[model samples]
Target: MHPIAKSVPLRLLVLLSMLLAGCLAESEPVEVAGKCGPRDLTPECCLKQNPGQWEQCTGSTEMVETAKTAHSVATRVVAAGVTATVALQPRINSAEHRGAELAVDLLLRVDKAIAQCVRRAEREVNDYHFDGRSPSRELCQQLKVGEQTTWAAYLGLFKHEQAWPCLRKALDELLPKKNYLLHPRFRHDGQTGKWEFLDEQAVKKIVSEQGWKGLTGSIEPDIVILDEKGFIVHVYDLKFPCPETNVATWTRYKNETWKDWSQGDLYKTALGVTPKLVSPREGVVPETK
Candidate 1:
């Protein structure tokens, strides 16, 4: 190798070593803005002092905040869009025009908020350093929740109205993972009336031909799991700020509220399986008999 080329590699190695040393030096304990007792450390301060606990605390906090912000922004955007669309109906006679107007209004209102949430979420995910790259799993999952929340809000607004079937396209975008009951499969046994898997194309065809009769209506679950026979194996209803801790609150969710809404029973009647409730905090509840 040429003399200059050999010297260049050595110089680069020394620079890299210096950069690593600087990072290590910067990791030393330092004061942060938050209040800290004489012997205590705030989470920010502890990041340098005790990185292990800091990782756990900060990771959990970030996840919780990311989920909350995503849900809140999604709810707000959808609600505003629905209200605006309703108000614009008299101004725009065509359904297409009203929907376009709603989309534009929502984009203007929430584009910045969504971008901020996405950036924060991406940063948190980058902190994990999985394989030296930020994993998309967490970010995508959060975004999916946001998408589902938006769709649910639209469903609520359009339910029992003429625009329902048009909005049902949102559900089609949220098909569950493969091997899960909700994912569309291609096989069915006609004789035993058991399906090896639910056919996505067939279901779409039915919806197109017959309307939203057997598929979905005003009352719907967050996720619908279908059996091989195209019957519902399980329905998942996601609840925000889950009612897990408070006994009285949980009682209302189980007895008075859900019972009156009959969402579970409605799914059962339509797809032959009772729905299960899910939450970010509590996860899936045990299936009720």
Candidate 2:
């Protein structure tokens, strides 16, 4: 009936309309898939999911090549909304780009360093104390505990005395003093699991010589990587399992501002980076999808 439709064969017009409909459906609104990899963020999805916060969509890429393409019809399209992907072959010539590269390199090294420290700690603790041998009958008797009980107590102390020091020393050697934060404390906002770092004085004020009574307890990450601007770019937590074969997992807070939340989820939301878990046996567990 239409003039354009009359110009073409009826079957052809119907096929053309069907094709147009399919093309239109492709650009229709969509929700973010929430399937982006841990370290990978799709700009369009981020804009869709977090309406006003566009900054989260950038910075993962060392260098960005702006593609002047059509305006993104919706935020959910991966290639639309905004576009930045890790340059397949990035040239690290600029100082700004260098800092990002270094941060990534340091993180990779830290993963290896943590695994080494934990393994060494286990070996050193066993070698120094009993040469990997169980406590003698006489020693257990002297301690007034059964051998199994004595061993369990020793394993508990092993983490504090051996693993803690070993990990701290290794990190000190690997990370530049100004670039990495060790055991940095954060205060949580009551409404959200989001955390903001506490300055040295603020930390001291809350945790006096007496106790941390009445105040919400702090969340401390084993290590936090700070970029040149001092923004926390990455987080890591050392998990030393006594048995060496146990699965490494994120800690879950039970009370206060961070109640009912897992540490990994909180860190990701607050820092905008997926926290890594390091253990002697697990090395660095792959990031969960």
- Give the alpha-carbon lDDT of every model: 0.30, 0.46
Model 2, span 99-142: residue lDDT tens: 24245677677778777876675565555556665444454323
**Alpha-carbon error at 285 in model 1, in Å?**
0.8
* Tens digit of per-residue lDDT, candidate 1, span 1-289: 3322222222222212222222211111111122323344333333334433423434545433443443233322212112111111111112232111114453233223322332332233233223324333333223111122222222112111212222233323332222122112222244764323223444445445754332322232334433233334444544432112321112112222234434445444444454555433344554464
RMSD of 1: 23.4
Q: Clashes in model 2: which pairs?
A: none
Off by over 4 Å in 1: 1-217, 242-259, 287-289
Q: lDDT of candidate 1 vs native?
A: 0.30
**TM-score of candidate 1 against the unseen true structure:** 0.26
Which runs in model 2 stand beyond 4 Å of their true positions?
1-105, 133-157, 160-169, 191-194, 208-210, 214-217
Per-candidate TM-score against the hidden true structure: 0.26, 0.52
